[model samples]
Target: MVMTNFLQKRKSVRDFKNKEIARDSIEAIKNYIEEIEKETETVSFKFYENGSIIYNGLKGKAGYSGVMIEAPSYIALMKKDEEKESCLNTGYYLEKLNTQIVNLDLDSCWITLDNVDDETKKNLFGAEGTKVDYVVAFGYGVGKKLFTPETTSGRYTMDQIVFKDEIGNEISADELETTGLLDIFASVRFAPSHKNSQPWRFVMEDHNVVLYMEKSDEDSRSLVDMGVVMFYFEEMAKTIGRYGKWSVILEDQDKYLKVAKFSM
Candidate 1:
């Protein structure tokens, strides 16, 4: 599928078929990981061929309420540092790699491992250069690939999540329409976030767009959340005529984080 269509229709599969991803598919994934690693400095991907080891080790100790999503394979993001940039790139490139998995006729779900301590993560995945902050379990879903995965997820309207010049300054739909960005923003509301919190907000200027995320708890997944939405926005923008990459703008605004800026 094309990028825009894939972003709009992406679904998380929690229940996967009892089958390991084929070896050829795993090789394709490794190539994708190597490609992604070169695009950024902070993060790399580790594919665990045997998902049982990770699932068994992380069960009752990871994910929401310590409930792990079982699958036939798992991929972890390894970043060199625990800084904001590392977390952001982790979410960005991980989601980018996720699209490749979907294109290969597979489904995946993001698994948060923050509740799992460092020692356990090291012991389970090994103590190499891998710092596994998050894992994505992936395989064929239980049914047909073409069917839409049933979803209960909802999204904010553009006005609810976007602003004209600054936070609390609402940007009207008609304004976005005039700027040729209404449909793009609407489609990106489908981007996933932790517990579906969304957490992403935008402030638009004449020549630039600024992204912000709610200040989540310290060591929380919200920065990663910012990175996920950032990819969506840039990809969606490309569908139109706007083309630019996000430049980090790490700052504080009492309750929200100033994440990045993109020139239009």
Candidate 2:
């Protein structure tokens, strides 16, 4: 399947069959990770066949009750710096991996490591400087289910999340339709976030799109969530031949924190 279609079909799977992934599929995943790491050079990933070590340690953590789905394998994400940019890069890289996993006919769910125990961290990373950011549990799902955009989880509408040239001025669907950005904005609207907070805002500035995170929603994980949304936007844009890149914008500080700018 094409990248855009595969991305649209992707959904969070919390259940999986007790089956190991094919060696070729695992190799493909490793190669893809290596490729992305070389491009970003800001994150590292480690795959573990045994999920029990991380799963058992997550027991009794808030918001994880009955939500921690067991799988045949898990991929641990790590980074050296604990700064904001590092967290955002972590999310960006993992979402790229998730897209590749979906294309391989595998399913995954993003697992938080905020409350992960020290021993579990040691067992997963086995290093000191690099900090664990998140984990993705992936494998072949137990049952087949057809998915569509409507079947996915609820999300904020484009108008609620996107703006026209400035914050508080929400972009209308008509404007997006006229500007040919509806599809790209739709992908950002559906990007995953912690508790589905959807704490991102975009300003359509000429040929560029400016990304911002709500000041109140600012946190380590939210920065990562912004990166996820940014990745979705960029990927969707690429499908339509709009090639651009992200650069941090640090001059603004107020209601919304300027995270990055997409220069087209």
Candidate 3:
């Protein structure tokens, strides 16, 4: 299946059957990880067959807020350099991998490892400078991979999340349709965020899309969330014959943190 089809059909599966992913699927995941590592130099991944170690730490963890789900296998994501860009790259890279997993006829859920104990961190990926950002559980789900109304998991509509050339001015669906970006923006709206905060806002410039984040005083996981949305935007754009690359902009640092500009 194409990435766009998977994007529309995929739902986060919290329950999985007691079965292993096919060896070929595992191989495909590893190969894709290698490619993503090359593309995003700061990110790295490791796969674990035994989910008990990670699952145990997730139990009653405050950071994860007791929402971690169990599965037969897990993928641990780590970053080499602890910088702002590294966090963004972590989300960007993992979502790409997640999309690939969906395309492979598998199910996955992004599991937060923020509150994992020290010992488990040491055992899973090591306790060095490598910062473990997140883990994903993947396997055959207990049911079908269809997006029901309940599974759609409501997101902020385009008017609420996107803007017209500036902040506060909501962009209408009709305007997006006229620009041939309605579908592309729709995919961005579906991108998952920490706590479903949906903290991103896009400013539609002439033939370009400038990304921004809602105001926050402290360092945010939402930066990672922004990268995840960008991944969706770029991939869906490509699938529909719209191509562009993201470039960071430095001018708009006051009203909002200028994340990137997608140039067509």
List model 1 lDDT by residue over 1-264, tens digit each.
Answer: 656677777777778899878888899999999999889889877788899988898888976555788899999888778899888888899898898898899898888776788778878878843478788989988743322535624667777888988888978889889887788787777788877778988889887888988886643577787788888788788888788999998898888888899998
Return the TM-score for candidate 1, rounded to 2 decimals.
Answer: 0.89
lDDT of each: 0.82, 0.76, 0.76
Candidate 3 global CA lDDT score: 0.76
Per-residue CA lDDT of candidate 3, range 1-264, in tens? 655555666588877888878989989988998888888777888887777766766566522347667787889888777676776787788898998988888898887766666666776577651377678988988865435557667778778878888887978889888877887777666667776678788898888888987756534587788778888888877876777878855344675778889976
lDDT of 2 by residue, 1-264 (tens): 554555566677777898888889999998998898788766888877676766675555411564676888888887868778887888888998898988888988887766666765675568541377578989987654434566566777777778888877866788777767787777666677777778898888887788889866457778888888878877888877777878877445777779999876
Alpha-carbon shift of residue 95 in model 2 (angstroms): 0.4
Which regions of candidate 2 fall more than 4 Å away from where they truly are? Answer: 2-8, 50-63, 143-154, 170-174, 250-252
Ranking by lDDT: 1, 3, 2
C-alpha TM-scores of all predictions: 0.89, 0.87, 0.87
Assess the local accuracy of residue 178 in candidate 3 as a C-alpha lDDT between 0 and 100. 89
Which stretches of candidate 3 lie above 4 Å from their native place?
2-5, 56-68, 143-148, 151-154, 170-172, 250-252
Angstrom error of the Cα, residue 232, model 2: value is 0.6
